[model samples]
Target: MWVQLRRSARTHVASVKGVAWTLFLFTYTDYKTIFFPVTAFACVAAPVQSYTRLLHGVIWIWLNLLQCNSSNQYKSAEEDALNRPWRPLPSGRISRSQASKLRWSLVPICIGFSACYGWDVVLANAFLTLTTIMYDELGFAGHWLGKNFCNIFGYVTFEIGATKIIGTSTALDYTAMISILYSALVIFTTIQTQDFPDVIGDSALGRVTIPIKYPEASRKFTFVAMIAWSVFFSSTWALGTLSSLIFCVLGAYVGSRIYLLRTVQDDKRSYVIYNVWLLIAHLLPAQTRWNVLPF
Candidate 1:
C-alpha cells in the first residue's frame, strides 16, 4: 500500500509538472506580444496607473494563453504527434481528458474576470474564445486564408479587450486603429514563415498553409512580406517616431536575413529568426512610448 501511494504521488507531481511546462511554453513565447496591444491602448486611452487596470491586462494575457493552448493542443494532437512529439499532450505527459477538463475550466474563470470589467470586456472575451474554438475544432487552421483570418481577428479581440480596460470609450482613435491594423497585417503576412519548419507534419495532415501550398514561391513571398514590413515601419520612422526607426532598422535586418537564408531548409534557424522578428515587432509599441531612439 505504501508503494502504491508513493507511485500515485509521483504521478500527480508529473502531471503538475507537465501542466506547468505546457503553460510556460504557451505563455512565455511571444508573451510580450500581449504587451504590445495593452501598451498601445494605455498610450492612447490612458496610461496604466492603477493595479486594477494592470491586473486586468495580466488576466487577459493569461486567459488568452490558456484558451489558445488548451484548444490548440486538443485539436492538434495528431499533428503535434508528428511535428512536436515532445509536447506535453502528444508525449503522453498529459492525457487528452485532462487537457479537455483544464481547457473547459478556463472558460468560466475568463468570463468571471471579464465580468469585473464590464459587458464589453465579457463580450470581447467571449468572441475570442468562440473564434479560437472555431479555429481549432472546425479546422480553420488547415487553410491559409482561414488561418490568417482567425489570427488577425484574434489579435483584434486581444486589442479590444485591453483597450476596453482603460478607456471609457469603446471606439478606437485613428492611431489606435492604425496600430491594430498594422499588427493584423504583420500576422497575416509574416506568420506563415512559422509553417516552414512544420512542412512535413503540415503536409502529412494536408494542411494548406503557404509553405505547403506554394512550395516554390513561399520563400519569395516571405522575403517580399519582410520587405513590405520594413518599408511600412520606415515610413513611420520618417514621420519622427523614433521607435519606428528602430523597428525600421531591425525589420530591414530581419528581412535581409530572411532573404539571405531563404535557401536554407533548417527549421530551427528559421524559427529562431522568425521569433526574433516577432519579438522586435511586438516591442515596437513600447519603444514608441519610450521614444528610445534619438533622432
Candidate 2:
C-alpha cells in the first residue's frame, strides 16, 4: 500500500513504485546488510515490507552521509553552515527540523531491529549511535586523528552488528576477513575518488581532506592503485577460495575500473557512472553464493 507519486502526473502508479523500489534496493546495499541479507525475508509476506526496509536503509544511509558531511572544516559561521543551499535539507524539500526528528526516529528503530536479533546486536547499535553522535554533534571527525579512528571503528561496528543479527560467527570467519579487507580498500578508494567532485567545495571551505592536500593527478593515481589492488586481491581470492562468485564480483569491479579509466577524460557523466558501477560490484556478492567451478 506504499504508493509513491512521481515528479510527473501522467506516470503510472506502478512506475512510481518501481522507482521507489530501486531506491530501496540501493539503500539496503550498505556495509551491514551487503554480505548478510538481513532484510531479505521481509519480501516474503508483502512486497511492501521490503519497500519499508529499503526506505529504512535509505534514510539511515542519507542521515549518516549528512553526519559525515558535517565533519568538513569551514572558515566562519556563514560558511560553516552544515547544509548547503542546494541540498535537500536547505532546499526546503525536507526541513532541518524534519531531518533531526527523522534521525532520532531512525536510531530507535535501528535499536529495536537489532534487539529483535539479539543483545549483541543491540550493543553494537548502541556503539554505532555513540559514534554517529561523536562525528555529527561533537565535531570529532574534523580532527585528523579522529577521522582515521572513525573509519576503522565504523567497519568494526558494522561487522559486529551484522554478526549479532545473523546469529553466527561468520563475521570472524576467513570469508569475513576477506570481506573486511575488501570493504576497507573500497571505502578508502571511494573516499578518495569522491574528492574529485567535492574538491572545489571542500577547498573553498578550507577543509583538510587528503585530495585537497595532494595534487589532483595524485587523486587519479590513487584510484588507479585501488583498481590494481582490487584486481590483485580478487585474483588471490579466486585462486585460494576458487569461488565463481569471487570472479563475478571481480568482473564488476574490474569492469567499473575499465570504464572509469577510459572515461576519465570526461569527468561529468563518467564520475557518476563510475560510482554506480562500483555500487553494483559492491552489492553483487550479497545476493549470490560463491560456487567453485569444477575443472
Candidate 3:
C-alpha cells in the first residue's frame, strides 16, 4: 500500500509538471512582452518580499499569462497563421479542441493559486478573466478602444496580483499606486505599438485596429505619446536630469523610428524596441523602491 501511494504521488507530480510545460508552450514568444513587465512590477512593488517568495509569485504570473495567451491565440488563430505561423496552433503543436480544454482548465488553477495570496489576488484574477472575455468573446478586440483599454487593464491586473502576493504587507503604498496608475496610462496610450506589426493580418481579418483604421494618424500618435510619456515619467518619478535625458533618448529612438520606418519588417523591429523601452519603464520603480536616484 505504501509503495502504491508513492507511485501515485510520483505520477501526480509528473502530471503537474506536464501541464506546466504545456502551458508554457502557449506563451513561449511572450517572455519579453508579458513576463518581463510582470516580474519587474512585482520586484519593484514588493520590495520587502524575499527573492524566493517573489520568484514563486512570478510562477503564478506565468500560469495566468499562459491562460491569457492561449485564449488570445486561439481566438486569432487565423490571423496568426498569416503573421505568426510558428505559434503552437499554426505550427500544429496543439489542436483546437485540446487548446480549448486547456484554456478553461487553467481558470480554476489560476484562481486557486491566487486564493493562496488572499481575496485581493483572487479579485485581480477575476478581473483578468473578465477582461479576457470582454476582449475576445465580446468583440472588444476587433475595435481600437476596446483593444487598447483591455490590454492596459489586463496588464495592470497582472501587476496588482503579483505585487499583492509578494508585497511586504499586500497593501500598495502611495508610490506603488501612483506608479502603477501612471504606467497604465502610458500603456493605454501606446498599446497600439503592437498593432503596427499585425496590420496585414488585422486588415485581412477585418479587425479595425488603430494602425489599420487610421494608419497615418496612428503613427504620429505613437510618436507623440512616446515622447510625451518619456518627459512626463521623468518628472513624475523625479529622475535626475541625466537619467531623464537618457530615458527621453530611448523613447525618442523608439518613437521616431516607429514614425519613420514603414515596412513590415521595420514595424516588427520597432515593436521589439518599444517593448524594451517598456520593460525599462517598468523597472524604473525599482530605483524608487530602493530610494536611489535611478533617474
Candidate 2 off by > 4 Å: 1-86, 141-149, 163-171, 239-289, 292-295
The C-alpha TM-scores of every prediction are 0.81, 0.58, 0.91
In model 3, where do residues sit more than 4 Å from their true spots?
1-22
Give the candidates in order of lDDT, highest first.
Answer: 3, 1, 2
lDDT, candidate 1, 194-229, per-residue tens: 777788888888889987788757777777777678
Best by TM-score: 3
> What is the per-residue lDDT of model 2 for residues 55-148, given as tens digits with 9 covering 90 to 100?
5443433443333332221112233234234433333444455546555676767777666556766776778777767755776555434544
| Selected candidate, larger lDDT, 1 vs 2 | 1
- How many Å off is the CA of 217 in candidate 3? 0.8
lDDT of each candidate versus the true structure: 0.70, 0.46, 0.86
TM-score of 2: 0.58
lDDT of 3 at 40: 80
Residue 72 in model 2: lDDT: 22
* Residues 22-136, model 3: lDDT tens digits: 5666787788887887788777876647887787788888888988899998898999899999887887878888889878899999999899889999999999999988988
